[model samples]
Target: MVSFKEIKNDLPAGIVVFLVAVPLCLGIAMASGAPLFSGIIAGFVGGIVVTLISGSQLGVSGPAAGLAVIVLHAIEGLGSYEVFLSAVVLAGAFQLALGFLKAGSIGYYFPSSVIKGMLSGIGVIIILKQIPHAFGYDESYEGSLHFMEPDGKTTFSLLFDAIRYVSPAAVIISGLSLAILIFWEQILSKKGKIFQIIQGPLVVVILGIVLNLLFLNVYPEMALSANHLVELPVADSLGGFFQQFTAPDFSRVLTYEVLFLAGTLAIVASLETLLCLEATDKLDPYKRISPANRELKAQGVGNIVSGLLGGLPVTQVIVRSSANIQSGGRTKLSALIHGVLILGSVIAIPGLLNMIPLASLAAILIVVGYKLAKPALFKSMYRGGWNQFLPFVVTVLAIVFTDLLTGIGIGMVVGIFFILKNSYHVSHTMLTEKTPAGKEKYRMVLAEEVTFLNKGNIMQTLRKIPANAELEIDMSRSAVVDPDVRELIEDYKNTARSNNIKLSIKETAEDEKLEYEGMKF
Candidate 1:
């Protein structure tokens, strides 16, 4: 069933995605307060295991930045990293149940405003967290998403601290890396087939290793310290490499706290995967629609394998999926190949990988972050109107100040408020007209559906009707009217008679024309 043409298209794309994923996996693991190797393991499981079962052709799964905050706290609260692994296992089981129950449709309920806000919020967090790493300040965690740092400094304050302790060597490497990345993307990448095959991030990383090595040899004083470089765990033999894999501790599986955390992870991961699935499908060149339920099932299996192998929790990451698309990945083979490459590199040349400096990776992420939170996106959202812009801005701010889940919660609330306001305003259309006889006539046209959300507006409209005026209540277009609204109409009818106002009701065949004169509740 496999074709050579497909491989030709996918292999190069896979290599590009692999290049993009390596540093992200390592950085996210560092951010989550987990062992660095666990990130690679998760990337392996996400690519090799999940891609095999996923319905999505281009969605690449890996450790997500959105989960970094939760993972950090879960590890701290659970008392050990292994216990958190147990929670991840349980979370996979939860996802499996969700898939079986066909709960993947829940993602459809989230507004586009909220989703965009989430993306922008995560982008801002990525840029803020990577600043110190970019300048070669390695005191803080590499992938942290929180504003408050473990060193008693806030995210903004850390910038000042990083400047005070700036490393000139790191600055130079990062500057050159960024320049190369920009040059490759803007000029060389468009000029030839070779540039298309060779990714800019890959070139930047390789060049960074070479430059740092040069600094070490030519100017010993400018050489970066070990802390400024990647630190992959080395294994001398195949058996020693196998020793790196860790299993989850099952002793904490029955604890209520563990179960609660597991449920939390499951809900969050599932939502994130579904959102990414929707986003990735939009970016597909063929406009392919991935099956949400199947994707959930695949993610559940991936997390189970990852947790068993001492990996962090996995989700469909938008960043990697977008990279896969941009790199011309045509199928799941690209993701699978990337995973195999990760395994091979770790096994064969981890020493070479270790030569990479954190500054180069930081430069790569800063570019990624800027793409996510581009100024044009904000301006476009603002032009869409207040109904769209309010929730978007609020979600971005909340996620920046708080955490992901909390920010989403706040955004959802704001989105709901806007929905309620629109519902109230759209319940009916009121018009006043003057006839040739100099008599005033009022017409109130009910909307297609009137629910309790329109109660206040309906009451306000009724109260504003002038006494002794002609009024017509129209419902011919309405398909459904709430019982509360019916009661309000009945009360208005009685009040109309008492106020000596002319009142008439127009109804459709679907509506009940109730005679409520002198009717008791």
Candidate 2:
């Protein structure tokens, strides 16, 4: 069903995404305390396997930074990476169950403000985390999303340290890379076919490699070391490469701890995937809505494959997905190509990949992060009023200060509070006025849908009706009236009778008039 023109557009985009994904896959693996090859395996499966099955055209799936802490802890608890991988396999099975149960609709319940906040928060975290890598401070793992470092340093403290120990060679490479990326995006990309065919990120990567090589020969003192470069596991033979693949230990599959960990991973990975799917769909220029349940199934399959191949658990990663969209990827082909590229690079050009400076990749991600958390977005959200702005700001702050799930949870709580407050106030409309004849008239209009949340307000309104007043309770507009509300209405009718007030119930055409005297509590 894909056309040649679509492939033409996707190829370049895939190259760009491939360039972006390499370091991320490597970095996330390092942060997760897993084998570097595992990250590559996950990326490959996400691209080649998941992309084929996913309904999402622009979304790209891979090992997620959001799961870094969980993976690290799971590995430590299980006492072996192989056992943790078994959990990943079971997690995939759990995700498949969720998809079949139609639980993916949970994504739709996430408030828009919270989702925007999440995007901005992740953007900020990306920029902050990349700062250390950008300045050649390789003490912390690349692709770490935590505000608190594993090495006793906070995110901000790392930035401060990075500035103090900044590498001149890294700074130069990153600076030039950033400048080229900007120029390509703003000017060269619009110039002609040559420019259009070559993506800025790919150019930046090549430049970094070439520049590092030049520095090694010409400016030896300014040359970067292996620690600052991409470190892919190089295999001397095909058998050696195959030997790198790790299989999950099925012996631990029935253990309570393993099953519990698998459930945890499933829930977290599914939530993260759903969130990324929503965010990626929003970022898609075509405005396509990916089927959420289908995405869960695709991700489930990817994780199953990844676990079998000694890879990290997979999710719909926003970072890679956003990179795909930004690079003009229009179909799943781009994702597929990127996967192929990753596999090829690991097999054929690992030494060449290792020559790439982390600084250059950091620069590219810095640009991506900046775009996601643009000042314009903040200004727009602020102007939209507190109802929207509060949740937006809360989500960003929570995400920046904590992990992605915790941040989203906090934002959801704040959003729900606002929802309940509004519901409490607007449950119904009550108006009391005197007619020209000086007769007191009280009119109460029920809300379209009434529930227990409206109970207090309804009771309060009824209690305030003056004695001897002409009261009319209208339920014609209400589609749902809670039982408690109906009981309250009946009780109030009795009270009206005792107060010598005339009370009448106005019902919809489909409703029967209530016999108030016959109604029992």
Candidate 3:
């Protein structure tokens, strides 16, 4: 059952997550080349829609940075943004099916170490990707893929370019915003009670908006354009608001291209959502487990709503989730309230939002990225052993060099190999006793799974058996008895004859050859 105490503890985190999610939601949409409103719509729906069905107490879902690449291609491949939105609607339906089928158990198969590595990897990626944006270089897309080259400029190259042609406006805003954020965390948080209640990021964001407004008023030529602001498609009245829905191109739904687009979106979005869910659960202070299936259903709903409203695909996001947890978010209400705030901002304060400089948001994201890719994360994984560290490092490298899906797939393969290795090494042992009778009474028991992997151990145990004694070989409870192990048992039976030992075999499934005179060494 849900508790009010839990909700109370989560309030602060939820607000923090809201502040972080807003800019991210906007930035990701911009990076994807989709409508900025699409990102906000995704964030709003993820918070309000997904929260209704989510099992997680503190997890906050929204437009994920990981989906930026997929969304960008999807918009292009589908040929029209409207057509692509239809595909998103269908993708949500598919996710709903996955939830109903109870496929969420797959989440449990992932090792904790691999999941941790993935979270940290995402954090590192966020920082690396946001460096140019933080420096006011907008050439490269925000939340770009690992190998993606935007406008013929590499991520690293753009950083150098930004440094060469640094915008004094961007520099001042970002620096001031970062300074305020830092000091807000260090000083104001430790000051009086009321000040501490107001988080540093919130204050920085507000101050950034005010600063930009002041710049616009005084130095209009130096001010950033409205294009840089969080643009919400607002209508003048309630009737206009009702007309804001974007209908999907249903005619294209049956086309092969649309199907392909839908499939790609479904797979990538699902992967990102699940990964974020896993990461969020790990960061949960109370260590609550989220029902993966339920999360899928909720995300599906959010996507459907977002797509219908011309929004980006939504997913459970780690940055927002972690911030939500860290800030003391307790209930889905926080997420819902965040969505309401987003809607209210779009409807009532688009101009005000435009006043906030992009660089300031970049600084916030940089901080978030650093927190995710902290040095302690590396040292902790290294100490956990190679089995843990290998997947962790590999995932990070793959993400850095490739894309999110590729990195996660590589990590999963490595994780599966570890599981198989452990499975092969498991020993199957059985103990037997003889009856206190002069007659050849025997008791038999078989190893757990007499597979080829256990052949050596089974052979050694058989060879050491005393001759000229009543012997019992048990196969009961054994799931698999390899042919080689059977051969060993046959050889043992035949060889024992020289010592006049009576051999008896007992198993749930009786094998004629291993049990009778037909037995051959």
Candidate 4:
């Protein structure tokens, strides 16, 4: 259904996104402690499978760096990679159920401060974890999102270790790679179409290969070992590629641990999808809005297929989506084509891809980490005052100290408490004055919509009246009032009469008797 003009625009963008995704796919997989092919499988399913059913014009889905930490621990906790795949498969089914229930809007319930903190926290972890790989001191493993290393070193100790065991060749490649990426992002990409089209990551990877080759020949001691480069499985034939695909372990499918993990994956993945879809829509020049629930279902299916094929869980990732938007993609065809390109490269040119150094990818991820936890973001959050700053800091610290879900949970608790505390202070207006005949008059004006959450303040106000006070409760402005508040009012009436306090209701809720036990209270 796409026009030729759209195709023309989308094709080049697709290529650009494909170039961008290759390294990220591999890097995220490496960071997740999963097989490199799993990341490719995720991108393939997210792009090709998800896009087909998606209502979004320019959303791109894949293995996100944000989920890398979860996958790493999930694999470790479950004790088998195949068992974890079963969790991922069930997670997709949960997402499908959520989509059917139209729970996509649940993502909006999270506060902006908390969400930003989560991203910032993840960013810090990424930079910290990638430091070892960046400097070529990757003795433990390629993937770790924790401060504590698998080999009994804390994050700071690991940094010291990295300095002690730094590889000159790795330092050179990664340093140069970071330079290229920064130059391309900040300068070259803005100068001309050619630079933008070629993409910095792709250029950096190619340069990394050329530089490594130079080091290998001209200075053997400076050369990166085979372990420092991407080690994608090179297939000799088409069938060999198929042989690499793995199936989930059904034996663990019905376990409580798998189900709980599945639920966690579903909720997190769906939330990330909703957030990315919203951002993508905003970035679209055409101002098209994607259907939230439909996108959830699409992502659900994508995860299911990916899990079935030994892929990591997938989400509508903002990085590739933004890349697509910036590159002028016009349709989902771009995403579809990008997925095709990924599959083709893995099958046909994996040898060339294998030449790309992990240090180059380390540089790319460092930039990503910096962008997420920029100093400017911290300054802005600080300026938003204690309510915002406290949650933000708590979430960031909790994530660095604990884990993603636990950090988010702690942040959410703080955010909800602050919301309720603010609500209690501002839910209504209270006035007290001496009326004629020396009687103290009190008036409580209810807010436009009052819920049970307002009970604490309301109850306090009602109980504070003295025996000689004249009180009037007004609800003329309120459209809806909770029965809990109404009952509190009814309870106050008895006390009013017994204490000889003059009490009158200017207006109760609209149909107070009817609202007490109806479809809505």
- Best-performing candidate as measured by lDDT: 2
lDDT tens string, model 4, 1-521?
A: 32455776788778767766776787678778888889999988888999889899999999876677778889999999999999999999999988999988876787878878877887787678678778988664443445565456777787788899999888998999899888888898789978766767667778889999999899998999888887777888999999889899979788888998999889888877886777577668899979999989999899899999999999988767866876668899889889988888899999887787778777766776677788999999999998999999898888787766678779989998899888777668989999888989888899998889999999887788887678878887888889998999888777887777777776755644211111111
Q: RMSDs, each prediction?
A: 2.9, 2.5, 5.4, 5.4
Tally clashes: model 2. 0
Which whole-number lDDT from 0 to 100 does residue 281 have in model 4?
Answer: 77
Number of clashes found in candidate 1: 0
Stretches of candidate 4 off by over 4 Å are 1-36, 57-59, 64-87, 140-144, 148-154, 248-265, 275-288, 318-334, 432-440, 462-469, 493-501, 508-521
Model 1 over residues 265-313: C-alpha lDDT tens digits?
Answer: 9999999899888878876899998989988999999999999999999
Candidate lDDT values, in order: 0.85, 0.89, 0.72, 0.81
Model 3, span 264-307: residue lDDT tens? 77777877788778888788767888889888888888888888
Q: What is the lDDT of residue 296 in candidate 3?
A: 82
Q: For each candidate, what TM-score against the reference?
A: 0.92, 0.95, 0.81, 0.83
Please list all clashing residue pairs in model 1, or write none if there are none. none
**What is the lDDT, from 0 to 100, of the residue 325 in candidate 1?**
79
By TM-score, who's the top model here? 2
lDDT score for residue 179 of model 3: 87
Candidate 1 local lDDT, residue 149: 70
Rank by TM-score, highest first. Answer: 2, 1, 4, 3
Question: Candidate 3, clashing residue pairs?
Answer: 10-328, 10-329, 10-330, 11-328, 12-327, 13-327, 13-328, 13-329, 14-329, 38-311
Per-residue lDDT value at 390 in model 3 = 86
Please identify which of the two predictions, 1 or 2, would achieve the higher lDDT against the true structure: 2
